[model samples]
Target: MRCKSLDFIFDYFQQIPTMELEEITFSGWTAIEEKNLHAGEKPKDEKVYTMYHGTFLKYVQHIITSGFQRSRDGMLGSGVYVSRNIDKAKCYPLNADKKEAVVLKLKVRVGKVKKIDIDNHPLQKSWHQNGYDSCWVPPNCGFTAIKSGREEDCVWDPARIVVVDVACCLDDKTRWDLRKQIRGMNNHGAKDGCSQCHQNTSNTGSHPIQSCWTCTKQICPFQKKHVCNK
Candidate 1:
């Protein structure tokens, strides 16, 4: 597909008054049985379920990876979903409750090619390295940047991210309850204590052990110290 500038894409989405839910096949892991499946195991099949739960809009589906066969290429067209049922997650604390299977809505966009000024290309070096060929910008978490091009030839642009509310699924009371629960969790904080280190102490010295940002768990200080010293 021809690459459009972020401003152009944003303008295109802005013209879309109503966003429609187009059911797309998604293949990925689920919280059904085995928490962690082997590489050869087939991924679970799921579809996008879009709905508006009062104030919050939800788009639940199995996680899906970008079609890129290689990992070195970085994440492109990957869809990420935040699970509501944290207990079922393999990485989450085992003692947590496993009740509802909910996930947060995600927004994704495909990368496209955009022509750049030959003299003032952003990715001029990359372009030269790739036999002075046309550059491609891979999609990231938010925006897309040209890949395999001279730095001066390519540029990153912010596109208009379209977030749609298909329809209302949860009632007012239920939505309010969920909102309250999420707020409470955010205010209180998540579970802590690193599984690897099991150290619950705070940073003592100048070079203290770093904690996992997600779970607020402290890593092994001794291990970090050894690595740094080496």
Candidate 2:
């Protein structure tokens, strides 16, 4: 009877809903902006735009913790590059595998915007020097260097770009890794696996199509039998 009660309690706990990091909703971007930006620094137009930044999966946690850093140099001079269109953002960190890419949703304070349409625009790399807070490149602006044929933006200050959320594409490799982790935790004789399965006494545990990991038999074959001697 004690064992049955323990089993019931374990099952109940397992059924409880748990929230993961990815499942958490983000709505505090305004609070972040309010705390970081002063009234004198805010743009007169004060229009906040949604943008995205593409990077490697390895940098997601670091960016979230430490915030974004301005790039030393780029096509648009030294600034953090982003895009209003998500498709354009996803094409970033160029020449890398798409499976490892991640996109960060950002809230940008694009104050006093400037457009650099032509290849040799005088302010192409010095717009910030002339008091422009951000620069935009329109789609298909007849620039030979604009390979994506999409619009792009570069914000001069990293503080103006607030990360709102992280988006990751779960490709085959990511899925396989997740499955492996779940299996390691759910197998018999493992850390969180069935303690009743004595057959799988070593580190390795078996998982065969709803079968018992201990004796490799039918699912929960010994649940009513009270003991498994197989």
Candidate 3:
């Protein structure tokens, strides 16, 4: 992707450990046992239920890499994934804008945070490095959902009906062009086959699909585009 960029979270992937990834939802690995029932729920000796952790929430399988996808306006995508080399996750304090509305507690005025909008991951807008969309997520659409209370209900929509702005320079064509480029790189091995499967273990974990780090200036139809001060 291309654009004029100014500011970006520089220490890419610092908050995360880079490692090999795996598919946690494969059924052969998970087994149903009578003792596996939910709290206070009884288990029939012959009854079996698939395990929930490590993928496969209910019957639908889950992606285990690079995280989710998002639109420029904040709409999220269908799947939430993680990387192969992960053990745990870390959470931050809350932003004033997120304190009440968002469930993911975050720190104040820190990094460029955004909800991946995919699968309602908190800290979607995160301070840590790689806290954007997974390799599959876009740049302009940089909001993070932080929680998963009513995912099917929430959407990645521009907050309000937009009116054309006059000051911006990049037009629809450029924006579309940039987005297309970024998405196309999804399968391109970022560095060797290491990027073969970029995943996020935590739902709130970010999997930013980066464009040219140089293109920091993100233009939106809603506002006048300003030159990003690099």
Candidate 4:
């Protein structure tokens, strides 16, 4: 399918079975106060300037990538636009300015970055906070962390699309149309809100129901009602 936005990619990851996925982790720079006092450290032990170091970058990669490509399409090197793989989503610490060879080497040895810390790595922090994951590294999605025995293939090839997301504009559009339809039925007596047509989320809010309008076999509550209302 043609990917018009990034949500298509995130929805794909959300479909992934969590049992097959891992929670996100990362590594980068951090700031720490200096503490090199000759005889007396102020405050009984004054702390000095800080520096960024990495120590856990490899872990947070997947979770962060999924988040970045969640809502909208974003930029990468060469102004390339594409979808992300939720299962293998993660970010790397290379700038567009870095040499491709160096970036490739760094990505392959992601685990070696364990010593790096977030405070030192502002970009990494940006990735984490913004959910930047699922970026393409050279041949595929960034290489997977290598453990001894479980040879799971982490690298993703764009050429081999194993799955795709279906087009479902029905959800949002239905709510809008339903409002019109219900309004026509009410002729101004019935109040129009999702809560009235649907129930409270139980958590205490309402979401519009999903369904197709004309071109379908009976699919969802909205569709069934369309037929019954007729």
Candidate 5:
């Protein structure tokens, strides 16, 4: 299937299985200050700084398990995108409902950094090629796309980033709605075989395909290796 948007795939995968609400333990996890940095400030060289990564709730468990993956293309090509500003992290997965949004607190080791404040910087997307470990975009620097007027950063390597914690960025009512949806999914799955597996009975003993959001076919497309291109 066409990749379309990351959020689109995540929308359908919301019923893959409920997220384990229990606290997760991360190895070698180090805590950093939760405060925000000034608009034009850069992280201390070769030192760890606190950062945030915004994403939908459905993908949280997967990310925590698999770790951050580098983006194939971005303002700073081939990097794991993050921001020191929590508000900026709260603005991601833009096309989806905010109720499913979450901000991941992280500890990042920005080995060497560069600034790309200009619209036409020679290495706007190629800073990694010049031995830079990260790129910084200052707020209100004439980048029309950053409506939040917030600072953003792109780390070249995902290994340099470690997930510290996850925070839900929703109001009480929205959180209620989220819990309701999850409970509904769980209840429905209990009654209807499996949502994700549909009729693919091979793995029924392990985890039945509860109700697949994709289609009603006996086998899920995803099980056949059909999935989002991106």
Candidate 6:
């Protein structure tokens, strides 16, 4: 059978008895910050920013490529995109240069994830949103910690986590289609106010295929009255 979107793949995997998948749900925030640069003799503030739609695609690619890792000091961990509605997404530095910044909801699944504690020996206290805790997860591992009495308990919920593994889940065609859809969305030229129908043209200024119309229809349910230009 053919799968059209990542959501379909996620649903299909959820029902497999032998696969033994565990779902992890969370939200992640990223921002397109404007930096003042001092270049050459003439130093001027350069506006460096990315489109919200493009950033969203990159965020998804990061999750697919890097997998998820445990957060440390409330920073530097991979996350996935989970929300179907772009409007409800979260973004950091709320006051970004462009209003197009966004936050993404992520739903991820892994066969297993190992949780460990680093509060031994001299007893170092680790800080997290929950509180002072020493729980840490290894690279390529997913974990969540809850305080229990005097100590924090940690365990390996699963053996490992893998994304887009052809031997296990997702065929080549489906993966290709997924990547193409993301790239097409990133390259689409309708960055201004939303239009009823978006004309997706190629870099060479030619209509390759009516791919954007189909993409907008299938992927952009959040868009208001947006259609693909045939």
lDDT of 4 by residue, 88-160 (tens): 1122232322111111011110111111121233432233233332222222223233111111111111111
Which candidate number would show the highest TM-score if scored against the true structure? 5
- By TM-score, the better pick of 1 and 5 is 5
Q: Which regions of candidate 6 fall more than 4 Å away from where they truly are?
A: 1-60, 75-93, 98-100, 108-230
- Model 5 residue 8 lDDT score: 82
Clashes in model 5: which pairs?
A: 194-209, 194-210, 194-211, 195-209, 195-210, 195-211, 195-212, 196-209, 196-210, 197-209
**Model 6, span 1-230: residue lDDT tens:** 66579778899899978856697532222333344222111111222211111123334455333333432322212222121122322333234433333232221222122233332312222222233222222322222331211112121111122222211112456445555644444344333311322332221133322223333333232232433343
Predicted candidate 3 versus true structure: per-residue lDDT over 3-53, tens digit per residue: 334224434446567788885431111232343333223222223222111
Could you arrange the candidates by lDDT from highest to lowest?
5, 2, 6, 1, 3, 4
- Sliding window of 10 residues with minimal summed lDDT for model 1: 62-71
lDDT of 4: 0.25
Please report the TM-score between candidate 2 and the true structure.
Answer: 0.55
- Name the runs in model 1 displaced over 4 angstroms: 1-76, 81-169, 193-230
Give me the displacement of residue 229 in model 1, in angstroms: 39
The number of residue pairs in model 6 that clash at the backbone is: 6
CA displacement after TM-score superposition, residue 166 of candidate 2 (Å): 2.1
TM-scores for the candidates? 0.19, 0.55, 0.16, 0.16, 0.58, 0.20
Best-performing candidate as measured by lDDT: 5
Cα lDDT of model 1 by residue, 57-136, tens digit: 22121011111121122222212211111221222222323222222222212133233333434643343243322222
lDDT (C-alpha, whole model) for all candidates: 0.28, 0.66, 0.26, 0.25, 0.68, 0.29
Q: Give one digit per residue, the lDDT tens place, for model 2 in 1-230.
A: 36998999999999999966665432211122323222113223346777789998777655654457889998899999988778888887798787788777777878888888899899999999999999888887786677877777889877576565554455756545434533343343333333443222122344332544444455432232432235
